[model samples]
Target: MLIHGLLAGSLALSGTPATTAQAKIDCAEVKCLALTFDDGPGKSTAKLLRILKKERAKATFFLTGKYVDQRPALAKRTLAEGHAIGNHTYSHFSLTPRLDDEIFDDIKAGQQAIKKATGLTATMFRPPFGHTDERVLRIADELDLAEVKWTGTTHDWALKDKKKIKAKVLSLAKRDGIILMHDTVPQTVQAMPEVIRELKKRGYHLVTVPQLYSGKLRSGVSYP
Candidate 1:
């Protein structure tokens, strides 16, 4: 599966197995997973945060500059509440075929804005559309950032079905995995509480991305 290859090549350096390996980690002491929501700072973003707090969980939010411009306070709120903020580029128009300099500029612009609003500098970048090539990786390396991606998604932005959202999350979830759900969709926010509940029932600890990878605070970017 695409996720298996992606996780093997990108996240783990020491041959960690795929999502099916969750059982061992799930039973491990202090089991953890990274929950990342992207392309956000939308109206639903705050609601998503509320659900996360009720679950007593945290997540990383990759916020686009366009959304930040529209909802600057929401972006600040994300940081204020201790969720890591990441740059999702300014326009999020497209990263494909763009030169390295252009992509870096876009990411930096996003970084500057978020820093301005929240006194936080984001060290994670999600290339638009999950489109990453050698150039994208190089730019992330140059900027001292990590390229963040996801293992499974409900495609909630496309489908509004809450049942499908919860099912997809549970179906593909794994310990220490980065699960992608978007903050722009109400259905996603609606589905997250149950998702967290199920993960808790199954003995998974939801962690920030940096914690998932490095056992550190979510200040810098990281993979898991």
Candidate 2:
């Protein structure tokens, strides 16, 4: 999951509004959050998927179309394994200095690739470097995609300490919440075992992004 060029990615989209709390959600009475791993269905992704399966937790994977181009089987496996795929754009460049034309094309390519790889179309997108503008949001909305803004983030891509990352994760995670972590970082992957264990100990039930949106819990966006 070497992002190659986008290493400077995870600053949480410049100028984003203060995060909305997913903590207060009713959770459809299921009481778990939607865990998301972005920037990949990369080399590390299969291992991550195995870990999640062991925990009986499903998550959303926002993968870049270019990466999927090379890892077609992994992309298909992501869906087959019961996780969700979200658009993370094709040839994922920084979304800053966002141009409407490129943004639209990026999203479309991602959609096409996901459909081709997984036989499903996604209605969610995570902007590269979290640096999206109105043009990006507008296209996503126009295309009926929901712009998901996560409330809890692990900052794991920064190689933060595993214990500290887990603490941040536990402190912020909530029912029907969207928890952001990355498969691109080794440290993040290391911290996941503990994070899953803790959440389950606390009685949380992990579910995929689609399930998060479709269940009795009141999600921010409408379901298919």
Candidate 3:
């Protein structure tokens, strides 16, 4: 995949070794759950990354271009730590309402921002607020991004309470599920330690979105 190739290139540019001792888990044979956080590389994201690292869990982060420009180091560390990154649009705009050229420009700007920040081109995208349509998907496809939607969302952006966020995540947990969250939310970051531990206890392998699909994602396709 283009993203995989970009990952390798980024690693080389950063002087990080591409090979890792981490053993690969085949999701097809195990209960795998993808924990995806969007709209970030925010202040709270560093804490979230620490929690994930302590739990030895890998996740996928959909980064907004504006935030990437603000926290380039955080974005680089995210990919370097073995988590996957995806474009979440340049300005976090709702692509569904925009004109076709505007949609293309926004998504393209996002791709450019990510590339500049981390030297990696993202092949996955999640529309802000989950607002998308066929046209949005087509525009993303032109940028070589697959549309990644969630099986369930914690709605942590609204809840804004750590306990409630944790509870919502537990309730929505499932095998091969892509769970939506926001790393920009402080309460959600606070809730992650407990959430990661509990999900592990439930025997689900916390993995990146691409790992959930075994890295066979196609551009323009919406995922499970």
Candidate 4:
């Protein structure tokens, strides 16, 4: 998927407490960015979570159903630690090319898998490969999910180089920006510590997608 045309804007923080033990920050008054990971609660994810915990940074994970089934414990731990979760569809298929029923079934299955594993329904959805349209949005709305698109992406799965992935993420950082990366990418996981450090050094609060929007996300609306 291409990363382009990122618009600058601010969003409100949800009533949920900030991931850290410190005072909650209002995105409207402070610089905030939401870091989102898509695909896999894979083997590398446990390490990623430890890094985030150490850094006191929070993120949002969009889980694919197949992987969630394979790593249910990790999914539960992810939620237990205060990061937000979202559905990335059951099989990670590009949604626009699929029939309406096919699209609905996949997304619904994703919801079920996440619920079965974590016991909490996801309030967010992101279409695989960033392939989404009116129909996908409609179905997501029906499923009570707000569609989330990234403001920028590291494309770390393709880059594979930790240094390059870190550079891409730094270049994309901005107020209220939502950055896309993948926990399944080992190199990306390796790069996250320095990425989190630099973002904090630059005075940005790392937040979940819901926290970035102040927890008032509208169903079917595509977000920043």
Tens digit of per-residue lDDT, candidate 4, span 10-103: 2223332233432356788778898999997998999999998777777889999999999999998887777788999999999999999999
RMSD to the hidden true structure, all candidates = 8.6, 10.4, 4.7, 6.8
**Per-residue lDDT tens digits of candidate 2, residues 106-147?**
888988888888777776778776776666677787666766
Off by over 4 Å in 1: 1-28, 215-224
lDDT of 1 by residue, 1-224 (tens): 11122222222112132222222233245667777888889889988988865666667788998789888899888866556677898889677688778888988888778877776766677777788777777777777677777877668788888998889888887766788878888888898888888887786766556546552323233343
The predicted structure with the larger TM-score, 1 or 2, is: 1
Model 4 clash number:
3
Lowest-lDDT window of 10 residues in candidate 1?
1-10
Q: Model 2, residue 188: displacement in angstroms?
A: 1.6
The Cα RMSD in angstroms, rounded to one decimal, for candidate 3 relative to the true structure is 4.7
Order of the predicted models by lDDT, top scorer first: 4, 3, 1, 2
Candidate 4: clashing pairs of residues: 12-214, 13-214, 14-214
- Tell me, by TM-score, which candidate is best: 3
State the weakest 10-residue window (summed lDDT) of model 4.
1-10
lDDT against the true structure, per candidate, is: 0.70, 0.68, 0.83, 0.84
TM-score of each: 0.82, 0.79, 0.91, 0.90
Ranked by TM-score from best down, the candidates are: 3, 4, 1, 2
